[model samples]
Target: MGRMTDQPARWTQATVYPDMWVDPDDDPRNSEGRAPDGELATLADFLANYRMTLRMKCEGLDAEQLARRSAPPSTMSLLGLVRHLAEAERDWRRWISDGDPLPKLYGARDADFDGAVAEPGEIEAAYEALAREQAATDAALAAHPDLGERLGRDGIAVRELLVHRIEEYARHCGHADLLRERIDGRVGQ
Candidate 1:
């Protein structure tokens, strides 16, 4: 178990997300083929799949392992990524929906990384929270069919929010790759 203040000298370097999760040599967005019925299509599909990619990258790791800061000066671990995404999803949701006025999920601005340290069930809880937030955000988007529908103070279009969500997930998935590699020697996806 990793304590809040105990840092490991040598972190395990392994890759968990395999090539099957993504095309061996193609961008994840285009790796999977389109559905013939087109029912399984939309910007949401891309965003959801990308989020799944990040989750897959951290699969099978214990809480301590997931929380290991494989890369120095970056305070990022699979666990931290999970917590950060959960917080981010909540923030975006609140921004898009009025009357939300909810306090941030992981506490104050810097709390995301602060609460990222390891403990039993921490990993599972973080993942579960992220999944719930993702589902809520998806539902909110579905409720408003018109992409042009303006939401948030900045007049953020629903379409733009969806696109931004996808971009965020895609970028984090890339970070997950390096984090996993640093944890253990495994590498592929």
Candidate 2:
């Protein structure tokens, strides 16, 4: 975004660490030595951190604040990110769990973001849906047990799927960072 000529320019998020989201001590995603060494464990930890970061970014926000499309010209919002991630989790779980390729959550069109309305129940429901999707995905992963196992029509590897899920959340959490900062001056997960 370009700086406005009329209004004073704003800066990107700043914290105790200029180059980091937060100080290492306060950073919630600081897995450090706690993160295990297995492939599955590594992917799971990254995905969990991203998911938790998303939730942290949305905490204490009201429906309007959560739904605010503060970044205009783009329909992205904290609520939209939550809803979108829920749909994504469902899609990934269906593929990983050997479920039929049912219709997409919001259809082929990017209806997920388009339909991200900031209504009363939607905010609560969005978070609930995200939690439900996460639980179902975790249960399915537990059943598989083997990271190298394949699923879906393409014979996609379970490890690949898990990595993709982490990538998805990482991408969206970046957007959520901006969205949350826009909603409130607060920054960091």
Candidate 3:
């Protein structure tokens, strides 16, 4: 098998136990008890798990690693994903709340990814922004438990929004998985 750098070959090239981002015992995404029973609960649980997966994939990496592009032609990076997700969470909150249109967190266009720099402060700020947006979105969603409730100018249902959010996170988390694996030969669920 080929290797990108002198660093040890990826776990895919060798046999490793568990083959996960973290040990099952310490994996926060692992369910310890009864699973969610209702539709909303199930969707929320999925979203939460994906969110944790993103965090876990980015764990143990420094700023440079987090901001490194998957390849020269791509702007994708764990740090950029963090910023993009933060933007998404904010948009979700806005869609549910009544107010003037909120400005973009990173400026217009694909600034979120383009602006993801490998500076310590930028890394901290990206994570902080993501946390803030996630909390705000969660609070807003909590206030509207009725998934059938329609929101935003398009009158999209909350149920649809939740599903869309889950899909978004899932896709991004997959990207995070590959990015993390490339960064450290570490691969897992």
Candidate 4:
């Protein structure tokens, strides 16, 4: 993969994060179009959109390109972001699902981004896995439309879970902005 050098005069807007997760602009749910009738429409909309933004920020890059650290000593890369988000989705789902006891996808805490590499196959697989997890999480959330439903180990409400997911995506999108800028000086929504 070619490293971004000499910033392009005309920067193309990134619709997906380096991992090719989702586009930033389109609706997170129903990115292809608006949500269907009777769908549980609420704060989840924002969260879905935000997650799409994070994915858009990392699109169109190869494995090595996605793995390039934005800054020295940061260990943060687009690929790492994908892996991190995948683990997070899994964790949140587990929390909401009453501890299904499924084996950890990335193994324990902090291991999500520990062994991240720039291999093409790994990059492709990571994004694919992230998409699958995101779909499953969305489905779980959709299954119980009642925002008042209590999920999570601590009795956290489903509404809180949706909000937290949005917060998570928003914070990472901020990181993505800087990472994208460092990669090739591209910026904005």
Question: How do all models score by TM-score?
Answer: 0.78, 0.81, 0.89, 0.77
Report lDDT (CA) for all predictions: 0.73, 0.76, 0.86, 0.74
Q: lDDT for model 2, on a 0 to 1 scale? A: 0.76
Q: RMSD of each candidate?
A: 6.6, 3.6, 2.8, 6.1
* Stretches of model 1 off by over 4 angstroms after superposition: 1-30, 35-40
Candidate 1 lDDT tens digits, 1-189? 855733323332332434333444444444556533432247767776788788778877777778888656777788888888888888787768767566777888657776888886776788789989888877877777788789877778888888888898889888887777666543535
For residue 139, model 4's alpha carbon misses the true position, in angstroms, by: 1.6
On residues 12-58, what C-alpha lDDT tens digit does candidate 4 reach at each position? 44456533333446434455556545424647667767777777677
Q: Looking at candidate 4, what is the lDDT of residue 61?
A: 69
Whole-model alpha-carbon lDDT for candidate 4: 0.74
Per-residue accuracy of model 3 over 103-142 as CA lDDT, tens digit each:
8999988899999999999999999999999998888888
| Ranked candidates, highest lDDT first | 3, 2, 4, 1
| Ten contiguous residues with the weakest lDDT in model 3 | 12-21
- On the 0 to 100 scale, the lDDT of residue 135 in model 2 is 94
Candidate 2's TM-score = 0.81
Per-residue error for 66 in candidate 3, Å, reads 0.6
Q: Which ten residues in a row have the lowest lDDT in candidate 2?
A: 5-14
lDDT of 2 by residue, 1-189 (tens): 965653223332445665444566766775666667788878888888888889878878788888888555888888888889888888887676555755666666667777778687777777888898889888877888688889877788888888889899989888887776666656544
Q: Alpha-carbon error at 73 in model 4, in Å?
A: 2.3
Model 4 scores worst on lDDT over the 10 consecutive residues at 18-27
**Which candidate has the highest lDDT of all?**
3
Residue 119 displacement in candidate 2 (angstroms): 2.2
